[model samples]
Target chain A: MCGIAGRILNAPGRVGNDLVELMDAQEHRGADSTGFAVYGIPRDSGYILRGMGFNKARLDSDLEEFRLLLKEHGSDFLEDPTFVTSDAAHYCARMVISDPKDLAGWVKDADTISDSFEVQSCGRSLEIVKDTGGAVEVADKHGVRDMIGTHGLGHARLATESSVLPNASHPFWARPFSDVAIVHNGQITNYFTWRDRLHRLGYRFLTENDSELIAVWVSHEMSQGLTMEQALKLSIKQIDGVFTYMIARQDGIGFAKDRYAMKPLVVVWQDGEFAAATEEQAVRRIYPGESEVINYDGPSITEIWGVGNRRAAA
Target chain B: MSEIVIDVGQRPIREINEEIQTACKTAKPIVVRNTLSRHNLGIGLPPGVDITFEGSVGYYCAGLNTGATVTVEKNAGWAVAEGMSDGFVTVGGYAGMSCGAAMIGGLIHVKGNSGPRCGVAMKGGNIVVEGKIGYQSGFMSHAGKIIALGGAGESCADALWQGEVWVAGEIDSLGVDVNVVEPTAEEVAEVDAILDPLGLVDTSRNWRKMISGQRLWYFESRDANAWLMI
Candidate 1:
């Protein structure tokens, strides 16, 4: 079992603490790994690189190697990367770099230096911090409670079909698609079939986690000129699974469940903000007000909260 | 019966729940006041106790109740009275989704609007909604009775398996394999017994009853259209 939570605020402010609190409420859902995709203030021409390590020592060495690789590839760092201890067994760092047209290629090349080193996310406004631990502890380690953003997505992963590794953690970033991330609860029955199709289309996958395919598939559809609402509506007919998933992009955050409504998802909208989670307890903790919380069920129930003028499709 | 009034706004949820549990051990009446949308209130209570929330509550209020009588004076969040077995829960105001979901044996009364999947997957229970309910009110239910007095949303009783549904108002649509059946005089009397206490009786309106057709339960090799029915 896994827990997925997301929050979208009408105004730009600090929401990392809200996400951490939300994740802590559903910590029982997952204990193996926890992570979050936070959308902070956007930059014009730089990429935010977030990498994970198995330990502090290895993370320091990997960061050194990553810096050397960036220098070797004629890429200039806009700011020095800062490394921090995420947990007893995990570490992470954030770096801002000048525009590299082949950012995906750069990330793939950086992974070859050490198996313990993995790029969690690379985007203009999104930074993913995740590791193996309790969701609250990991969030505290990454200082997620202090992050300010417009919207974000988080996951508490209980490893069932995969190993307990950072690479297998959720809130998977849709690679090569800036500012796209997804957190899903439920299994994808047709994972390999869809993965193979995307792989044949020259889309690369870093992890074998089935939830990552949702991000890839949705990103593919959005790239094909479909709106986020349209892409999610299409997923209901295509993706075969008993799933409830939430997506966060540069523009908005939205959630969709399978037609069967097999998985549990409760949403609360209050004061122009929306909070969704695998359970209503998590949402109540975030917005402890008198908002009417709705149990999301039925066929193709989609809700989207856009940043500005973008209205919800459902 | 001694009354213990605890203000939920001033105390933690855990403390309030523990106090309620302690009160239930002695079969005392507990009144929880200032419950400003706090989740998980009145959960896992013992039998023969009466607990009342003076204000609105958050999710899972009175969930998993065995035999306690829980009353919320205001609106409730999602999953109100979920998984309840042998108890009575009354919502004085609106109720969120999945009200009385998967109940084994109990009675859940919602005096106002109930959100979607009101009696979903109920094993054995009786739920009465005084106001209109959201879509898919009794989806995938097995062996229970759902009475919606005002009306129900689209696909009112989808995938019903041996359960019974009676709606007095409009049904936007019906789910797959669910069929409306004429209610007998005995069945109408049974419904009257359930709603008479709530001061809501609509004998003039055509009360529709629905049941599962059981078309999706079996497979026939000779039947060509059986696969498409599901």
Candidate 2:
């Protein structure tokens, strides 16, 4: 029970603010959390702006000096993270770039950072920020209300069996690998079997949701130097039961439906542009023009856009 | 007086229904062309209209029919007259399984082989399969006459009541509580009356008639031989 939408434009460069407007219609699909990944690198460095916090007063006073310390070490920090309290209960911050080598180094210094946080530039091609809340709240606070991109993916989670926590919110990004995420619909009945196999391969899992297992499987295959499409095509065979999924890799985005075509995946591709969603209404609401719209049955591969225009491998 | 000619040109059934629903409000017949290999031709016909699907239908062709006459120029799908009431469905080709299943009041004519359970739990109307039928032809027929042109499958007649069954083919086996009985010439004429609309008559002096001994509804065993195995 989630909504996902993404579009690929032929005249790429950057999309302005319309992305948030498109996602706003599907806010009900995910009430617990909201987020988006902009396909650009943040310029400022070392200043990790933690957007939403319960104790703003405490974090304001406590982290002020540490924020200054980062600026003192040839690092420029911007910490005025804004949270759109009216709509979204989230916040966003921009960090300055100082020491280029120490980008990942600051992540290990957990003692200096108060909150349980994470910071890493995935593939140096994408920036990911996700938290618990609705779309308006997240977009208002993160300043994504006016954000746009040529390629991106978003998920609004409807937690069926799992608790509504930050980690459970999608689009789930696989750890230790950047620029790879997955948003899925339908259950993985054979999750345990795959989980056991992944554990044997020294891969760690973050959430109990079966959807997360797919990220690990794909990441493992990618680590072997297999391209994103190659890895996903291979992983589809090992998974059992009905499922329709979309994978956002560093270069491109891929979507797949199960063998039986049990789940739904509607795609509309036209004029060198493509948009897909769980329902036709979602796609129509955004693109709403006459185009060739078709339902994705089982065992079909659609590669909409990628790093260099690679067709989705069947 | 507008004639809507529907030929197979990649138009989905949903699109056709929109036109049919509008035409029914003004009383018109939908003339369908190139119905061969077209699936779900006249499924779930709307009220107050007549639809003549000009060719064979794929699967679940005329299911849940209500207040409409759907005459197929060719064969029909599985469960052709499933749960239909107050309508008439005629198939010129072979029908699959469970024809007129749980039907209330409708008429279904099949010109070819019927798979299995030709009329299961038929409450009203009549189903006449003009060709051979598969096993368990009428497993639990409650009401309705199942006229078979060719032979019947194993267990031809099971536990049935109220309705009548006439099989022209050889019965391989009998189901539980099914009785074979001699039919009077007057009763034979009544069976022939149902086929008059479709113009199918077998007057070769070699017709066999079978009926439930009315024991299913009354629950009495006057005759030791539930089936008159002649």
Candidate 3:
């Protein structure tokens, strides 16, 4: 079980501030990792920000190495890149890129050269951070308490089948494709079968968690021109067992329940926006009130609006 | 005495429900002043003329109601008329599990989805779910009629005893000892009779009559482990 929060903001210059606060409040959902992706208009990308602990000396050195590596790749790092630290290992970087095509290569290279700390794109131009601790500490350390974005997704993880390192934290980015990530609350029983198929198809995988496989599988399906709804519907037949997954992309977010609806997914739609969670409390923590909540049973589809609709709701 | 009003606005459940019971001594309608009340609200009554919960109740509300006519303006909880000896439990929303469990007599009607085990072991009365039911509904049911308008989950009518299960949607899995049999002439007449009251005879033909496999309930000995035999 993990905590997932985010919004499809109607008004926005940037939505980082709201996204950070939402993710930060749900830290206990996952003590091992905290990750988020912000889908913004005009700029779309992804990042895997890892925690480097309170060792300012080590982090400073790591930062230097990271910067040098960026320079070696012929990409200039952004000035005043954000880096916040907490008692629990936490660090973030704000990078600006002119070329979206180079994202997959850059993320793969970063993962390869970063030693054991893995890196991958969560959709295009999205950013993810997974550290060894809770969400609040990480938010305070990273100054995410005030950061907001237009359309963003966050995950607080409880590691079930992956390493406890930052590399294993969600939202696990689907490789090669930026702007696609997922924070799932149930097991994907067919992960191995799908993983093997993806592997043979030359799609790369960076983690061992079943959650990661879901991102890749969904991304692959989307790449094949299946609408997000179609992909989700097909997946229900392909994957078995109880699950409630919130898959986020640069364009939108989608939630699906298993055929049996064994697990829970609650949503509250108010004032033209919707918030969802595995439990009612998670959504209430962010938008407090006696809002009408929908308790979905069995194979309900909810697609969160993307940044394209930003001006409409505003 | 004036009628008591228990406001169950996210208040502790036991407090509100128990208070209603005590105030029910006046035989007046104890209004639970909330539009949304979750599970097990009005249950296990001794006797009362009339009581109404203002809002929708969660699962198992008004369970085992005896000698009362409970009307809910919204949805009701599971087992709405569970073991009800005599009463009328009406829901504007959905009624859930064991809507009339082992009930002697009563009426329960839901406007939405009901979970599994509906009308389980119901002795008498009619339970209606305008929506669907989950798996293992009416397991070992002794008697009663359960009507479902939506698709059923797996293992429907499992080990059913005497009773009728009417479904309007496709069945996922039929329970053991339970086989689809042609509706008897009496059964068809009964359906027509029931539908006539509700003013719904359009799907009369689509409604399939289901009953327990007599082998399980009529066995003279438990020596064969009758459950598996059924």
Highest TM-score: which candidate? 1
DockQ of each candidate relative to the true complex: 0.39, 0.04, 0.13
Better of 1 and 3 by TM-score: 1
| Candidate 2 chain A: worst-modelled 10 consecutive residues by lDDT | A42-51
lDDT at B107 for candidate 2? 85
Worst 10-residue lDDT window for candidate 1 chain A reads: A305-314
Candidate with the larger lDDT of 1 and 3: 1
Docking class of 2: incorrect
Local accuracy of candidate 2 as per-residue lDDT tens digits, B56-83: 5545667778878888776554567788
State fnat for each of the candidate structures. Answer: 0.39, 0.00, 0.00
Q: In model 2, which regions exceed 4 Å deviation? A: A12-18, A21-32, A41-115, A119-125, A129-137, A192-206, A300-304, A307-314, B1-46, B49-230
Cα lDDT tens digits for candidate 2, A192-240:
9999998898776656778888777877787789876676666667787
Kindly indicate the candidate among 2 and 3 with the higher DockQ.
3
Give one digit per residue, the lDDT tens place, for model 1 in A47-139.
888876666767667677877777766676799888876336766778888866576667657757546667778888899988778877887
